[model samples]
Target: MKILALNGSPRMKASSTYHILAPFLAGMKAAGAEVELIHIRRLNLEVCIGCYTCWARTPGVCIHDDSMADVLQKFNTADMVIFGTPLYHFSMSGIMKTFIDRLLPRFEPWLIPHPHVPGVTGHPERVQKPYKMFLVSPGGFPEFEHFDSLVATFKQMARMENWEYTGEILRPGAEPLSRRSLQNLFTGYYTLLRQAGEELIRDGRISDNLQLQLREDLFPGGKEVFYQLAEGYWTEQMDKFKVPQEQRHTVPLLAKDLDSTPMAPAGSNITNDTSKTGDRYYVSNEVIMQTMTAMYDTKAAPNLQATIQFQIIPPKIDFDPGEAMWYLEINGARCDLHQGKTAIPTLSITTPYEVWYDIGIGNVDALEAFTNGDYEATGSQKLLNDMLHLFPRPEPGSDDPLAAELDTLMMGMPTAFNPEAAKGTNAVIQFILSGKGGGLYFLNIAEGKCTVQRGAAKNPTMTIHCPAETWLAISTGKLDGHQAFMQEKYRVSGDMAILLKFNTMFDTHTN
Candidate 1:
């Protein structure tokens, strides 16, 4: 069998989308199938101008003379066509979409009932030989909803072309799993995705079980750990580029208006006593339970099912030892926060409460704590990682008024809200942050100007809701907003078209 994999990511070598395909391609090659990998961005392809030239003037060919013409031939000759892309705006990337559009020439303009299948639905009839269609996409988010539109488009395309829909591989949390330490965690996933390819080559289709596994969260460590790791990455990037906190948050509407930046967030007032000795803000059992109940967003991780037991040691803990032992069970969409223990829990973690407190407040380095014998996991490390978000850190420092006002502190930062991207646009965008430190804010932009307000919009064009920590991470370039949206960390309901201005509206890096 001959396979053509068209990679649409512009990142090229740095793309996590491309990397996931490595094992799959290797599996196919090992199975004795000839595979050709092509990066679409590398080709000099022109966007389709919606002209009927391809259909009316010259059939089976786009009007523009570009490298896509050769790509078209390869696509036609391949026994199977694999569309590989990084999910963008709940769909394929612009380059890949354009490639799909250009392929319109290979089908008749008029629609009819699918020739091969007897269905009431009508689709553009294919003029060339049929080839099985498969999609390999990696979404940054952990939610399956991110692939909703992309999956629909591909399935429809397959039906329209009268080709069998082989299956898809939608790997969420692609970035987090790509981390060096976490790469080993995906050893089974890598083997499975590659095995999927082998199955395709040998059986002419991918296994259903493997397809389901591909769509599972690539980083089972959950969103909290993922965000922490992401933040470290963004911090490094900021330092590498020497991006000032002011500019990092500034969204210049006009290049000329760079000097008129908004006021940035103030520095933290709580000073850290570097000395690791302190039981002043010691975390109690109640605090842990309240924090979990307040912060856990069932919508963000709807299908995460696991039972975790926390075993706290004495001296480090102030609460009753019996109360210190807690169990958190997340079944389906419900989370049952139970105090005490379970007979056969999915996972158990034993640690000093002091170390746990420090880890919670970002004071203790988890790896170091583990290395220093502060904590130990008696069950699956993966489960412990997945449940880490349930124990979010309290605001840094003592539980004082200043700690509660951390969200407001972040509000003062230059949010990089580019009004220029909305130069000829007008919209009211609402930001509803949940969790312990969340708040509601709105950005009203029109006529190349933006007004930031502390309350909700009366009639908003779009409303984005997420945990406060997630937004903070995105603002700092530690977590990508696009990725967050895909991962279900944030849900957007309203005019999604306005979000397309994200990149054009703000420069993520400093000059």
Candidate 2:
């Protein structure tokens, strides 16, 4: 298949629309399709003057001598045409709209009903063979309803032109590609896009399920997160404009009229905007333990008689490597939790309490935490992998009652609990977790006391990046940290030898 994509975003290579299309192009190439992407903004495109000269002076060719001629040639030769754009005022960008108008020369002014067609619909007169058209549009808002008008226009245009409308890829929350926090959500979305492209080439259509997934929220936090991100971006832009803080909240130049315009109350189907500022929300540990217990009771848990014991310890003096520990034991289909050390533990997990706090709140992906070296496990890899699945995944920004409950489980509270671990120590370590559910964390140890903070550390003795889940397994003694490091599951910087002293500095006493 030969595919030609017209990128209408003014941002061109930097646009979210292009970011979405890149993976699709890769998938198409994998499926043996020849693809060409053209950034429309780079071309010298002029608005249509409604000159009718193409109809009267020259047939099937525009009279205006410009870049449109080249665009027309590409359009006529493509087996499938993809129109990619960002939503502007509930429709396509001005450039894209003009590009559609310039397509007029390809169709004769006369419209007549097809003799063999059962529907008896009028069609535009064209010289080339019929081709399929697909739409790719990504909006910053979280609602698909914002695309209703734009999609309807394309459907109508396809009908009038007697062309096939293969499908549309409309995604909301398009800012995830640029935000570190939304990396996990964005990964799932891009994977779906790649799969959709492959199916489109092999089966001539994207599966319905893939289309549904494409429209799903890119952030688990839903509409509120979407608008919150938007506000933050706008605020940053406002700062660049040198606007005063008092005037910062005023309506934007483009939105002033709309804000003043009288409008009817929104319909029941409308999802109201909820972008109010508040503390960061996360799932609670209590909810996570309860969910795990429920999963253990179900078929998800294995029925093994042999006991597999695991210990979880924080980097605190009270949690000294050998004295203080939280033991969680798995026997048969039951799971038991107890405080203090286990004489002979199967595995032990060691990390700062904040890392576990992020995992419990569903802010960090367990696997990412492992790969990032957020935690280390010291036991059997097989059992560690199995036990990891015992925990349920919380839906990001889901509207389900349970999801909503988890979102606000502990609305306002501190998650980190290591106040004395840094005492007598003088080192700073930064952990950068990747993949889904991973974020930056900083551990500052000074004068033997330790304090943890989110984001980067000022100056660090050592830095680590790993997967969250694997880190958890390694921390719990389920997976060997040395083996993981050797296998390239994580990377380190600064003084590598300092990492070996972490046990003594943080009091990670092995059983």
- Cα lDDT of all candidates, in order? 0.67, 0.63
Worst lDDT run of 10 residues, candidate 2, spans: 256-265
Candidate RMSDs in Å, in order, are 25.6, 25.9
On residues 1-511, what C-alpha lDDT tens digit does candidate 1 reach at each position? 8999988888765677777787898899999999999998999888889887877778666789999888888888998888989999899998898888777677667667656668655646445676888888888776778899999999987776677888888877677544665677788888987898899899987877877777666555677877777789879866765535633322222323112222211331222223444443444655544334434556546655566577766443233423678876665566667777665455666766555555644445555555555576555454454444543433333354433454554454236656656578788776665544555566777777766765335566877656667776776577877877777777666788877775576555211
Candidate 1, TM-score vs. the true structure? 0.46
> What value of lDDT does candidate 1 attain over all alpha carbons?
0.67
Report the C-alpha lDDT of model 2 over 1-511, residue by residue, as the tens digit.
8999989999888788898898988888889999999899888888789987777788777867889999888888899999998999899998899889888888776656753355666546666578889999988777789999999998877766666899899876675564545556577778888998899999999998888777777766767766787899889867676635643332232332122222222231212122322222222323223223332322345553222333343333222223234555565555665554444344445544445545643566666666666666554444455554554433233444433332232121113223364345577776554333444455776665566665444456887655555554555566777788888666676777667766545433211
Q: How many residue pairs clash in each candidate?
A: 10, 52
What's each prediction's TM-score? 0.46, 0.46
lDDT of 1 at 367: 50
Which candidate number maximizes lDDT?
1
Clashing pairs in 1: 141-487, 142-487, 249-414, 249-416, 250-416, 251-416, 253-420, 264-412, 265-412, 265-413
